[model samples]
Target: MKSKVIERIAAKILIEKYQLLENFYPDLLSGITDIIQKGKIASRFPYIEMKEDEISILIKAKELSELKIIELWNNQDTEEFRALCSIYFDIATLLDKDFEFKNEEEIYELIKIISFGYLGEHNHFVKNYLISKKELIENISVPEQWNSRLLVTIFKGIVCLVAKHSWKDIDNAVILINQLRKEQKDFESKFLNTVNEDSRPYGSAELVSLYHFAKTVEILGQYLLEGRVNGNEFDIENKIKYHLSVAKEFANASANIVLEMLYKYFEAFSIKLINIKTMENKVTPNQIIELINSLPDSEKHIFIENGKYWVTQEWLCGAFAGRAFVNEILEDAVQEMIDYLYKHIGHDSMVGNSVTKSGFPNLERVKQYCTPVESEQD
Candidate 1:
């Protein structure tokens, strides 16, 4: 029988309703020839890279200096400049790049621009990209790899909590986070007592867990810190930069722990390969092979499985490396990360109030975990 394909529901909702690259750019250019004319938008830009060029042109030709450029950048035709600037501005906003824009209007403007693109030429690339991202995001499911699988369990639990903003979602989110706090009481009786397997140094799957924990935690924390948000017209377009920033910080903390664990595992694995038994320079390749050949079948099997921690191939003597399995998981997640930022850029670069919103719970977040959204939305 053929296996069923699982669609990541939360990721899809985040993308489409939140306007992650969902036609915002194509919409901006729909009436490009008319709304932002050739000679008219001297200080505006079409793409992200051109913003600097636009500013330089304004300064050189029109003789606008630093303050004047700021004035022009700020005070230009609201609809025209916003639509142009936001391609870069909104991306920066989502990324919290340089600084965040405080005005709700600016955020609202992004929604408008993305909505415009929805009606015009659709950017299937952005949509496809975001949809593809949905596949990468999973709750921390593989718990067997950790020493303290319960901590792994906690990480998974907290991840779900902070992943949404509705009244029901927030209530549960609060409950989950508090549960993690309470778990400090027992479960081997150490506070936040993670596996601490730096010595045994478990597999890289732990790192994958850490990565998802980071992603999930960030999403959830953002919801709590920022309070509420809506996707599309239904309070979904914009919200909670402060909360997101905090959540990202927390996620990075988990990532750091994962990094430390991976490095230590590699260190331990490397030591095993070296010639500590004889205490001379490291053993010769032939000597290492001979040593392995002498081992019994069970030892050999165990050696190979654990040896995978140090290197990939069977023949190598010593390259001093671990498999870095986290990279595989990270690779999938990183693509979604890139797409999310790009979609925000697309959304941010809109003009006027003629924006749009889709009732979210479609993809990016809706803690219950359902099938992905493109099939339903499409």
Candidate 2:
């Protein structure tokens, strides 16, 4: 048979089989169809093409019992089979509340495939399904034999998904983020202890993981601030602050290992703080200044040399300087930060170009504090 013909046959058989099983499965057929449709659409992007064999694998996998499916998953190392495993996991969530893989290794492999493989279409479904499985995710114990970095990748995937759909379960979202925060701290502590100065520069997996998870928490916090809350404004504001605190802690811990994270962390923090100051009316200019001052002075010296300025630091300074330019109340405190940055990084660099290019308001005043390359050179 032609490959296209075989794929169509496999797809038809799978659709019909899922339809019949839907009576017992509930939404099983629709779920598979949704996965296929989305997968096709996602394949339009480069480096993510869906193969015809994947459909055949899904058809064969769907017809087998759960135990057989697991056996197949364990035995096969092909991309098509991994794609099938991802689909099986997604459908299993609907079928069994207590459904779990044979071991953490299997779980890790499945997540690895989902995170980096051609399973982009199943991500949304799996993410939504896992939202209700917080206990399952939390209870799964990581054995000492399993790779901790793989575990981090799994949690990072979960965190990214939950953070994106935070509105679905706000409280659960917060709990998951807090859990990830603790796990990150524990992982970093252990990983750092094993490293020496020679390996420290290359030991960025944990740091990058921290950056991703921290950003997700920050995103979730931003979502909470923007959405209508059942509680008081103080409650929401406190939550936002909690999220920011987590980011700050991560930034401080990672500063020595990866200096760029510090700049990125402050950039995100400054934007969120500005939002709270302008929208919530809870954060004061003094409070912002105090927080900025609390950042370690050690990291600032990196930019003190000529031609050593990082674009990230420029972004960080722009975030505050732009806000200060628009709000008179924030001018003095923000100017203090900008001056401190300017004194260190100097005026020969593009200080606030990011803010200006982003179309920040009060452009003329922002330029005054955040001198552009053209103006500085002139």
Candidate 3:
């Protein structure tokens, strides 16, 4: 059977089993049926070629009992299930232009499925689905299990806003990103608190999520600066300055967390190595200090004093270089540090090194980078 036939059959089975259309959107059922009969529903299957297993699952779905079908639908790990859900949403949209999702459960369900699909492949339909639900997306409360997925979805939405280039979109993007950063920090804190061990490193998932948001905000700041210089349609120089300032703030926050995590990891590793007395050439605090001392003058701002380690842009660069010594889990932390340094110091030509570099981001320096050059007329 053709893909559309299988998809339509899958949709019918879903509707019959869950009665979602009948219960929540009684008016849509006939429109959905009419469109299917007339072949007016556009093919919304993901662009990738379906695996044989997924095709087999869909073909056999018609034979399965309702319980079995529900099992398949709930099994998010299977490609066939995601495909089915995508088709269901596609049918809904065709039937009703607004695709008004009535309740939080429905929205959460959609985000869970779409977020999974988004991480694997760049699905334009899924992204558009999220963009269409922007208001609901902002307001709904996500369950604990699905918080990470929701974060990923919101991050993608912010990226979409940056690409659109309108002033309203950019302003909304700024708001969303700042909100996203806060959510990520809270998520990470909650996650770390749940771990039994006090010295265990930060979760890689949280680290990577934080890194992506921080990097995206930094890019958005640059885009705002470029817009201020190139366009006259929007007088947003102050907005650009504000955005850069916020971006610097986020970068500093990310850098502080990453640095602390790295320090804890190193401390934990040193303790582990020290416990293994049989092993020769174990890592030591003094050795780490010597390594820090060997860093370039620009990086001398990083040092261990009174058992506390400090981070600077130069130190972050050095940490990135020696990242291999750290565990695989800290890889995202290393990348975050490098991106933070590059954003604040590496490419910025106007800002000079400061006497009181606090190992955190200098907002003044960031503003200096945003200051328009003499040649570019306002």
TM-score of each: 0.20, 0.29, 0.28
RMSD of each: 25.3, 18.9, 21.7
- In model 2, where do residues sit more than 4 Å from their true spots? 1-135, 142-168, 175-189, 196-200, 217-221, 224-378
Residue-wise C-alpha lDDT for candidate 2, range 256-293, written one tens digit per residue: 32323333333333333344335533322233344334
Q: What does candidate 3's lDDT look like per residue over 72-175, in tens digits? A: 64364564554444444443333333334444344433433343333223256555655666675455454453334444444444444423323345455566
Show how many residue pairs clash in every candidate, following the order shown: 22, 0, 0
Predicted structure 3: lDDT: 0.40
Whichever of 1 and 2 has more lDDT, that candidate is: 2
Which numbered prediction scores highest in TM-score against the true structure?
2
In model 3, the Cα lDDT at residue 193 comes to: 72
Residue 9, candidate 3: alpha-carbon lDDT = 92
Query: What TM-score does model 2 achieve against the real structure?
Result: 0.29
Evaluation by TM-score, superior candidate among 2 and 3: 2
